[model samples]
Target: MSAGTAFLGSAGVLLIVTLIKLWALRKNPNDPILRAVCGTLFIGALLFVTAAPPHLAKINNWFGTPNIAAPIVYCILTAFDAVNIVLLIHWRGNDDAARTRRQTRLCLTAYVAVMAAIVLLFTMGDAPVERLRDLDTYYANTPFIREMIVLYLAAHTVAAVTMTVLCWRWSRQVPGSLRLGLLTIAAGSSSAFLYDLLKYTAIVARWSGANLDWLSTHAAFSLAGVSALLVAAGFLIPPLGQGASSRWGMFQQFQRLKPLWLEIQSEIPRTCPKPMSWWRSMDLRLMQRERDIHDAVLRLGPYFDASTGKRVYAEALAEHAERRRARGEADASVIAGAVIAKATARPAVSPEDRWMLTSTEDPEDLVRMSDALARSPRVQAIRRWAALVGSRG
Candidate 1:
C-alpha cells in the first residue's frame, strides 16, 4: 500500500478501538484518567485523519481559511501530548492528592497557552500559496509562521521526552503484560521525540536557505505515524491483550482435561445434564465439565479405598527415595491414579475415610490426576496393582 493508505488504515483502526473504549468508559464516567487517556488517543487519531492529504483541503474549507487546518491539527496534537502526561501522573497513583491535582492543572494551562499561541500566530501569518500537505514547510521562511511551527514542535518535543522518561521509570515497577506495555509506550514516545527533532531541524535549515524539505515533509511524518501506531498498541495491550491471553489459557486447560471428563461422562452419563453445544459459552462449558467431574467422583466415593492410596504412596516413595527429589509431580500423579483405580474397583469405605480422596478438589491436583489417568506409567501400574489386589482378595 501507499504511505497515505497505510497511515489512513492505521488511523482508522486506532479510531475504532478508541471509540469502543470510550463507549465502555461511559458506564464509569467518574474516572478522569480513563477519560483523559481515551480522549488523548481519539484526538490523536483525529489529528491524523484531518491532516491527511485527501482531507486537508476539506478541513481548510471547513475552517474558512487558507491552510487553517494546520493550527487546528497542532492544537489537538498538543492537547493529546499534554493528556498523555496527565494520564501518566494519574496512573502513578496521585489522583486525589493536591500535588497531582496541581500538576494536572499546570499541564492543562500549558496546553491552553500552546493552543492560543498556535492560533494567534497562524492567524497573523500569510500563507498565500495555501499549501495543504506541506504548510509548515511552505511557510518555513515566513516570519510568524516560522515561530508558530517552532512553538508547536517545541511543545511536542517536551511532551515526548517527558513521557519517555516517565514510562521508562514506571516500566520497571510494573509486572506481567503491563511492564511490556509501558516499555512499548516509552519506545514510541522516544520515536515521537525523533520526529519532532527532525522536523524542527529541517525547518531551521530552511531559514539558512537549505532545501531539507524531504526530512520535514516525508521522514518526520513517517516517524510520527509509526509512533502513533506503536503508542496506540501499547495503550491497548495491557488490558485487552491480557484478557485475550487469559481466555486462550482457559480454552487450553479445558482441552487438556477433555479425556478425563469424557471418561467420567461415559460411565455416569447423568453426571452432565446435557451434551455440550456450540451455542454454549466456553467458560460455561468448562464450568459444566468441572461440575460433572466432581459429581462423578462423588458417586464413586463409596469405592474410594484409602488403603489403595497408602499402598501406592509406599511404592512411589520406594522408587523416588525422597518426595522432593526429581519427578515430584510423578509421585503426586501415582497417588491420584491409585485413587482413580480404587474408585473403579468399588471397594467398601466408611464415610469419614472417603475424605482421603478430597485432594482432587484442588484444580492443579485435578489436572495432574486427570492427566495421569489419561497417559502415565503410574496410572498403568496402579491399574495392574488393582487387578492383582482384587484377585488376591
Candidate 2:
C-alpha cells in the first residue's frame, strides 16, 4: 500500500524479466553488444531489488537495524553502469582508432567516483528509509534528511542525463540494427532520468511547503522501474529477432539453389562444338567459377530470394560461356591450316566455318554448353552457331 512497497513490487517484476533476458543472451554470446547490454541490465535490476523495501525489510528484521544492502546494491549498480560505459567506449574504439582504451578506462573511473559521492551523500543522511510508513512524521521532524534526499535525487538525475547524452552521441556511429538498439536504451535511460528529475522536483516542492502526497512519489518510482524494464527489453529483442530471420532465410535459399547448380553442371557438356578434350580445361574452369559464384550467392542468400539469385547466376554463366566460345572460334581460325585440324575436321566442315574443330566427345560438357546457348536470348536469336554447324556435321 505504501510508496516503497509499490516500487518493490515493480522491481520484483523487472528482476524476473531481466533474468530471462540474461539467460537468452548467455546462450548467444556471439553478439557482444547485446550480451554486454543484457548483462548490465540483469545486474542493475538485481541491485535495485536488493535495495528495495521488501528485501531490505527481511534483512532488517534479521539484524534489528537498517540493512547495509542499500549501499551495497548502489555499489553493484554503479559497477554495472561503469561496465556499460566501458563497453560503449570499446565499441566506439572499434571504428575509431583515436578513441584510446585508456580514455575509456578514465571515463569509467570518473563515473565510479561520482556514483560513490552520491552514495555517500545518501548514507550520511536519514538511515535509508525503506517504505513510506513514517514518511510524513519523518519528513516533518528530519528537515535535513529531506534535503539530503533532494541532493541524492539531484546527483542521480545529473548522472543519468550525462549517461543518456553520451549514449545518444555514441549510438550515431553504429550500424542500423545496433543503432536502433542503442537509441532504445538511451531513450529508456532518459525516461529514468526524467523520473529522477520529477522525484527531485517533488522533494524540492515539498521542502518549499508544497503538499505533494504519497501517491505522486510512488507513481514516479513505478515509472522509473518501467523505464529500466524498457531498457532491458530493448537490449534483448532486436538482435535475436534479426539473427533468427537471417539464418532461416539463408537455409531456404541454399536449399533452392542446390538443384539449379546440379542441373547446370549436368547440361553444359552436351552442347559444345569441340572435342571434350579440346575444351576440357575451359569447361572445367567455367564450372569452377560457377561453383564459386554459387558459394558467393549462398553467402548473400539471406538478402534475396532463390529464384532471383538463380536467374542472376545463370546469366553470369551464359556470359562466361559465350566469351569462351568466341575465343575458341578465333583460335580455330588461326589453326585452320594445321595438320591436326585437317586430320580431325569432319568432311562436312567448311573452310569458312570451323564447328568441327570445336567438337567434343563428353556428352555432359556438350549438354552444359547447349544449356548455356539455349538460355542466351542473343545466341538463340542470332542462330549463328546453328547455321555454322549442323548436328550431322
Which candidate should be chosen as best, given TM-score against the real structure?
1
Summarize candidate 1's per-residue lDDT along 133-231 as a digit string, tens digits.
577777898989888988999999999999899889988888878888888889889999999888978887888888788888888878887887777
**RMSD for each of the candidates:** 4.0, 12.3
C-alpha TM-scores of all predictions: 0.81, 0.55
lDDT of 2: 0.51
Query: What is the Cα-based lDDT of residue 309 in candidate 2?
Result: 23
lDDT of the candidates, in the order given? 0.74, 0.51
lDDT of 2 by residue, 27-110 (tens): 886765556666666666665566555666776676664634544554565665565665565555566555555766676677
Please give the range of 10 consecutive residues that has the lowest summed lDDT in model 1: 324-333
lDDT of 1 at 275: 49
